[model samples]
Target chain A: MYLHHHPFCPHSRFVRLLLAEYGLEPELVEERVWERRPGFLALNPSGETPVIVEEMAASVPGAFIIAEYLDETRGLALGTHRLLPEDPAGRVEVRRLTQWFNEKMYVESTEPLVRERIHKRYMSREQGGGSPDATSLRMARANLRYHLKYIGWLAKARKWLAGERLSQADLAAAAHLSVADYLGDVPWDEDEHARDWYARIKSRPTFRALLTESIPGMPPSKTYADLDF
Target chain B: MYLHHHPFCPHSRFVRLLLAEYGLEPELVEERVWERRPGFLALNPSGETPVIVEEMAASVPGAFIIAEYLDETRGLALGTHRLLPEDPAGRVEVRRLTQWFNEKMYVESTEPLVRERIHKRYMSREQGGGSPDATSLRMARANLRYHLKYIGWLAKARKWLAGERLSQADLAAAAHLSVADYLGDVPWDEDEHARDWYARIKSRPTFRALLTESIPGMPPSKTYADLDF
Candidate 1:
């Protein structure tokens, strides 16, 4: 299998973590989505990443779809490391939290902050990529705190975000937080339980590849790769 | 089952359509999300619509989660109305299209149009909703056409939006378009194939409830409920 992705995109990173957790190492190709390269668009008309081309020549796009695809195909092979719970209700909770991060946290926090702090540097001025807008960044930061508190609340109520076992919900939350952490945006000290929960996820072997990814001219924060932090 | 929803919210409507298709009738309770009702927030801290209280006493929130929950629990009982395909690849395709409508189409078209044309009337002047912004509506309309063309393209390529059999992808597409149609925003003449696909979905018994719903002081367009249209 081969995967096309952007280094800083949370969704892309989510898929990478899932792949690593499944113990499958697909060839990774970095995609510059803003350029809308015709080749990439041909592979996935939505012009987004990460797009996974299976050995059977099937092209799977969108992070949520890819995660489900991987689970359905290879999750059982792992024996007990399945990213989704087998029961219907447990699956519902995992998917709910997954969508919560993928859509809610993304729209309200991750997307705006990343676009402002990271993507703007790579984009042309005509594409609205100059200095980051202070107002937007401030709004996103404000939104981030509420999400962190919610994470803390969930952490206190359940062993994992969705239940007793690790699931896509944990991966999804970690994926978004990792990107924000790279930019030094996550105020980890604000919520101790949330930070502790994240620490557990951060130390996992699957997360090692993500922590070391450095974008050109946009290095991650000094503490980004530190497991102790 | 009980569902708290808003008549104009596409996600809410999507859940309703799924329930109807599954032959499960959930008692409906309209939620004014903009008001941020304390009771509703307790049920779902996100304060979003389409929260389902199942017979098992689980509060299944979010449209995607609820759809999967219903499918997993009751899909087998029906034998043929499964919203997700059995195979992994087909499921990925179905989910990809579902996300395409839920996120991409929503961000580009539905949310903006609905907020401007419908939500604005319900909001107080202090809440920033007196009149519709002409620019937003125009941009949403332009984006709508591209999405409609994409839908048309997909419809022509497959028996249903995702594949040979109808799935959540078709319902998702129809759900968003149904809302747009309610406001007379969809130019059905732009794509005959897309229109025909929608007509087939619109004529289903499950859609009858949605067609008869009349939002106070905001009547649906003349052609909105006409299946023959």
Candidate 2:
């Protein structure tokens, strides 16, 4: 199986982290989704990455479907341990948590940062020259507190976000944090539970590729690579 | 089992239509999600409806989970005639189509209509009982055409969307069209495939209730009740 992915996309990174934890490496092909290549469009008209292709199957599909397919085909026990819940309520919580991190967190935090600092270069549109607009960065910074607070609240209430199992909630949360970590947007000092959660999640063997990610003209925070962080 | 629904909520209506088609009926209890009452939030914090309570389950769940539960527990012979597809690709398509109708189509079309027109009574912040903005209505009207056109395109190419079996796609599309039909937003004249598809979907015994719907402020189109149309 091959994954069409972009380093900056949180969803793509979410799948990558899971594959990392599961120790299943795929042929990683970077896709510039916004560029709209005809060949890529043929694979996924939605123009979104995290598209997985199984050599035996029909066509490309999105992340959730691929995760499910992986579970079914590989008989991967990773879900039960690291990415999914043992029970129904736990599973729903995990899915809801995953959606919360991927969509809500992206809207509130990542989007503004990406638009101001990353989108222009990827689209080759010179808006603000991909500079971090002060207001957007401020907003992204403020929003991160709320997300972290929420995660902290969840972590304080349970051993893990999706319950006793480490689950996809951990992976999904880590994916968002990876972007924030890359952008230096995460406020690690705000919440102990959230901070501790991130430390454990990032220390995983699968997180090595993520730590090495470097976007042009942008650098990780000094503490980003710190294992203790 | 009971359903908490709004007549035009595609998810609620889709579940209703599915129940009807499968020769079952649940008591219906309608709730306006925007009100955000504690009672409704207890059932689903998302504030969306079409929640079902089953006697067999330890607890009730939100729509998709509930529907899947029903499909499993009801002992219904939906095997070949199932709304959900069996093949992984087909299943993914059907699930995505369901999400498309419930999430994207609702976001794109239905919510604007109900929020601006039907839901104005519920949106109390408008001190003047503010008239529905013509610009948004116009945009929504145009969007509905595109949505139906896309559905028409999908219907034309496949035997049944997700293919070759009368699945929930038909029910989902029919539910959305029924709501639009009630508000006279549907443009059957714009696409032949959509027009014909609606005719066949509504002709089912399940669609009889949709035909009888009437809102005090806005009556359904003259042809709304005409099944043969």
Candidate 3:
């Protein structure tokens, strides 16, 4: 299995955490998808990532096709802790939150930060000299607190944001936060449960590779990798 | 079971499609959630529509939650047509496509159109707008084409959007396009596959309720519900 990802991408990080937690490490090849070409675009025409490739028949579907393939082929669901619930009602909650964090949180919170704080430097349009807009960062900073408050409410109610089990919800949240933490944007002290929950997840062995992630000219905070954070 | 929904809500329509496809009907109660003083908000602090109330639970999750409940409790998944594929890999593709339509396409495409073409009198300053901006709508319009183009490509490649099997991908895509069709936002003539697919799904008995939806100040195009169009 080959996973095409960008090093600092929250979506990739989210998928990586899942791979780590599940103890399945695929070979990772980083792709700068924004620097698009015909070959890479064909992998995901939408030009998004953490695209995982499984050697399925050509007729099969793609990214998600690979996930379902991986989950079933590896018998990942056979574990005592299932990523998705078997009970239909509970599974809905799992899937919804999995998407909630992936879509809503990504849109409302992480994407803004990445665009304002990170993308300009890498993309050719705003390559050099001009600083990433402080105003956009401030807007993201303002919007982020409300999002944390929302997540805090969820963490307060359930053992996990989605439900009683640690599922994709945790991975999704961690992925965004890990990327933000790389940029040093998350205010972990603001929400105790969210902070504590994230810390617990990061301390696990699977998170080690994520903690070791480093970007040039940008630095992780002193506590970025600390299990105690 | 009682479902709390508003007719124009895309999420509500998504669940409605599931109910229609399965030939299972749940009692519906309309709630003007924003006007409720701390009541409905307590049930779902996020305060989105398409919430379900089973016999015991205070507020069941959301549309995704209720749809799965019906699919399981009523054995709605038993039909010759399956929303999710039989295999896990195929199932994930359906789920991913479902979110792709709902989360991305909705935000990028339908939202701005709805706000511009509708949402003015029925909306408030606090509901994120009192007036829809034309600039945003223009951008949304451009983005909608790209989204449609992507879907057209996938539809062209597979017998169904997700795979050879007709699954939740169709329902998810249909859910949004049906709403757009009701408002007449979709340019049905844009692409052959998109038009053909839209017509096939709209013809289903499940789409009957959506075609009949009436908003307080706005009316749908005369042919909004016509399968022949």
Candidate 4:
């Protein structure tokens, strides 16, 4: 299997973490999605990153679908670390929290900050890339605090984000937060419990690849790679 | 079970369809999400609609999560009409298409069009509701055509949107299109195959309630309730 992704994309990073947890190592290819390369567009007409080509040569697009696919296939093979729970109710909670971070938090926080801080520096002028917009950055920061509080509230109530066992919910939240942390945008000091929960997830072996990924023009924050952080 | 929703919200409509398919009828309550009523906010902090309070009184939020919950808990009882395919690859395809309609089509077409046409009239002057934005409507119309063409391409290629049997993918797509159709916004003539596929879905008994729903000052289109359309 081969994975086409952008190093800094949170969705791509989410898929990577899920793959590592499932014990499958796919060949990685970096894709410049903003450029809309014809080859990549042929694979995914939506022009998004984190498209994976299976061994049978079929392309699978979107992070959520890829994560579910891995859990259904490779997850069954491993017989451990199921990203989703067996019970219907458990699955619902996990999926809810997963969407919470991936959809709501992403649209409200991650995308705006990442677009301004990272993508803007690399994109061409015609693509609306220039100096970062101060308003967008400020809005993203404000949104981040609200999200962190919610995460803290969930952490206080459950062993994991969704429940007792680790699931894709944790991975999804970590994926988005990790990207924000790379830019030093996450205010870890604001919520101690949320920070502690993140610390536990950050220490996992599945997160190693993501921690070490270095973008060409923009480097990760000082403590991004520190497990003790 | 009790479902809090709005008449034209696609996500709320998506959950309603899923419930009908699963043989569950939750008492429906219309919510004006823009108003941000405190009581509704307590049920879902995000203040989004389609929050279903189960018989046990647990609040299940989000369309995707609620659908999965119903499928997991009740799918075993009926022992037929599984909205998600059992096979891993087939499940991936179904989920991929589901997200395609729910996320891609929604952001690109439905939300913008609905906000401009319907929601804007209901909103107050201070809340930025007055006249429709011509540019937004035009962009949404153009985006809708592209999405319809994609749907047509998929309909022509597969037995259903996801595969052989009808799945949540079909329902999710229909839910979004139905809302647009209510506004007389869908250009059915542009895509013959997609129109035919929609006609089949629209004829389902599960769609009966949605067709008869009337929103006071904003009734459905002339052909909205016609199965023969």
Candidate 5:
């Protein structure tokens, strides 16, 4: 399998974490989505990263689609360890929270912050790149606090974000938060419950790759890879 | 089943269409998401419409989540008529396109147009509602044309949006576009293929409810409910 992804893209990070948890490694193809390369657009007309092509050449685009596809194809192999629960109710919660992180959180915070802080560095002026927009960044930071609070509330209420089992919800939240944390944008100390939850997930074997994968010029925060933090 | 939704909300419309297709009628609870009612927020923290509470009282929120939940729970009964195909490959396409309409199209066109043309009329000044922002409307209109062209291209190539069988993808696109059409915003003459696809889907028995659902003062366009249009 080949996965077209960007290291700093939160959605790509979410899929990468899922692939690692499933123990199915794909050859990662770094895609500069801003470039809107015709070849990449052919693979995914959306021109978004985190599109995966199976060996049979059927390409699946979007993180949510990939998550369900992988779970359906590979979940049985993992049995009880599958990231998605088998029961419909459990699956609903997993899917809801996954969407929460991927859609809501990404829109309110991650997408803006990443675009301003990370993507701009890689994009050309013609591609709408420039110095980060302070106004957008400020709004995103304010929104991030609200999301972190919600995460803290969720983390405090359950052993895992969704339930007893470590489901996709945890991975989704961790994936997005990791990207924000990498930029030193997450106010980890503001919410201990959220921080504790992050610590637990960050220590997992699957998370190691995310900690190590960094954008060359923009170094991750001092505590980004520090598990104890 | 109880579905908390707003008539003009594209996501809610998508789920409503799906429910009608499955022959399951829901007691629709109209929610003004801008009010942020605590009870509604309890059901869906995002404060978005289209949250469904099943007979068993399982509250499933978000359009995409509700779509998958309904498919998993009711799809088997539909057999060949299931909106999501049985195979993983087919399912992925259905999901990807469903998201394209729900997420991409909503962000680009439907949400902005609806807010500008519909929701703002109902929202109080304190609720951050007023005259539509011209800049946002202009951008959304341009995006809508691009999206319509895309739909036309896809329609020309496939028997249905996703494939030979009618799937969630078609429902999703039609749902969003239907709302745009309601406000007389879609340029149907510009893309005959898209217009033809819309006509076919809009003629379905399941689409009747959508045609009749109208806001208090904002009546649909002259051609909104016309099957031949």
Candidate 6:
């Protein structure tokens, strides 16, 4: 399998974590989506990242669809360790949170923050590259604080974000949060519950790969890889 | 079941059509999401519509999550008529297109058009209401044309949007298009294949409810409900 992705994209990070958790490895091909390459667009008309092409050439696009695809194909192999719950209600919560992180949180915080801080640097002048927009950065930072409070509330109320067990909800939230954390945007000190939750997930064997990933001149925050942080 | 939704919201329409197809009836509660009602926000903090509350009070939120929840809880009884294909690849296609319409198409076309041309009409001045922004309307119209051509290409290439069988992909696309058609925004004559496909799906018995629906003052376009148009 070959996975077309970008390390800085949280959606891509979500899928990578899922693949690792499922013990499946794909040849990761980093894609600069802003370039809008025709070949990549053909793979995914949306020109988004984290598209998985099977050995047989069936391509699965979008992190949400890819998560369901991976679980449908391999969840049975992992038995109880599956990221998706078996019951309908449990699955609903898992998916709702997945959508929350990928769409709601993404539009509100991650997409703007990442686009302004990370993606723009990789883009050319004609591709909308420049210094980050201060207004957008300010709005995203404020939104992130509100989101962290919500995450803290959720962590305090449940064993996992979805329910009693770890599911895609945790992975999805962690995936987006990790991206912001890498840029030193997450105010972890203000939300202890969220901080502890992140610490637990960050220490997982599956998270090691992400810790080592970095952009050439843009290093991750100092404590990004520290398990104790 | 109780569905909190707005008639013109395509995501809500997608779930409504799915419920009709599955033969489950829900008490429809029209919600103006912009009001941000405390009750509605409790059900879905995202303040979006198409949230379903089951008889036992299990709240399933979001169109995509609700689609999966409905299928999982009831699809086995559907036998060969399941909206989600049984095979992994086909299921992926069905979901990929579902997301395409709900997120990509909605963002590019439906949301902007409806918000500007329809939603703002119902909002108070304090809520950012006024004349539609001409620039947004122009952009959404152009995007709709591009999307229609893509739909036309897909319609001509396959028996259904996803495959040979009718699935949520068809329902999702038609749901969004039906809303646009209601406003006379769809250029049906420009793409014969898309028009034909819409005609086929629009004639389904499950589509009856949506066809008969109308806003208080914003009556549907002349041909919105004409099966033979």
Most lDDT-accurate candidate: 6
Per-residue alpha-carbon lDDT of candidate 5 for residues B1-229, written as tens digits (9 for 90 to 100): 9999999899999999999999999998999999999999998878899899977757999888888888888889998999999999999888888888998999999999999988889899998789999999999999999999989999999999999999989999999999998888899999999999999999999999899988777788987999998
Tens digits of per-residue lDDT, candidate 2, A1-229, equal 7888988888889889877767788899898766777887787756677877768775545655555555445534654564664455555667667767877788888767776767666565442444457987899889989999988998888888878878777888888887887777787888999888788878878788889889878778876888896
Better of 1 and 2 by TM-score: 1
Error of 3 at B166 (Å): 3.2
Q: Is 2 or 4 the stronger prediction by lDDT?
A: 4
Tens-place lDDT digits, model 1, residues A1-229: 8899987888998888889888889899989788999989988889988899987757999887887788778878877668898987788788888988988899999999889998999899977789999999999999999999999999989889999999999999999999999988889889989998999999999999998888788878866898888
Residue pairs that clash (backbone atoms under 3 angstroms), model 1: none
What would the per-residue lDDT of candidate 4 be over residues A6-117, giving only the tens digit for each residue? Answer: 8788898888888888877989999878899999999887899899998774688987778777766766666545789876677767877888888889999999988998
Q: How much is B211 displaced in model 1, in angstroms?
A: 1.2
Provide a comma-separated list of chain B TM-scores, one per candidate.
0.97, 0.90, 0.88, 0.96, 0.98, 0.98
Off by over 4 Å in 3: A57-78, A126-130, A147-164, B31-37, B57-76, B125-132, B143-160
Model 2, residue B118: C-alpha shift (Å):
1.7
Give residue B19's lDDT in candidate 4 (0 to 100): 90
Native contacts kept, each candidate: 0.83, 0.08, 0.33, 0.71, 0.92, 0.88
Total backbone clashes of candidate 4, pairs 3 or more residues apart or in separate chains: 0
Candidate 6 lDDT over B52-159, as tens digits, reads 998775799999999998888898888899999999999988998899999889999999999999999999999989999999998998999988898899999998
Which 10 consecutive positions of candidate 4 chain A have the poorest summed lDDT?
A72-81
- Between prediction 2 and prediction 6, the one with superior lDDT is 6
Higher-lDDT candidate of 3 and 4: 4
Candidate 2 lDDT over residue span B114-213, tens digit each: 7787777655674324568898889888889988988889889986655778777677777877877877788888998888878887887788887787
Clashes of each: 0, 5, 1, 0, 0, 0
Better of 1 and 5 by lDDT: 5
Q: Model 5, residue B165: displacement in angstroms? A: 0.9
Which regions of candidate 1 deviate over 4 angstroms? none
lDDT of 2 at A70: 53
The whole-model lDDT of each prediction reads 0.88, 0.74, 0.71, 0.87, 0.91, 0.92
Error of 6 at B133 (Å): 1.2
**Per-residue lDDT of B1-229 in model 1, one digit per residue for the tens?**
8999998899998898898888889999998798999989988878898899967666888877777777778878767668897888888788888888987899899999999999999899877778899999999999999999999999999999998999998999999999999999999999999999999999999989889877688889877999889
> Of the candidates numbered 3 and 5, which has the greater DockQ value?
5
Q: Write the per-residue lDDT of candidate 3 for residues A1-229, one digit (tens) a residue.
A: 6678877777888778777766778798787766776766776656678777656732222323343445555534558576666665666666566666666777777887877666667777634324577777787777777777777888889888888888777777778777777777888789998887787778878788989878678778777877887
Model 1: how far is B68 from its true place, Å?
Answer: 1.3
lDDT score, candidate 3, position B131? 69
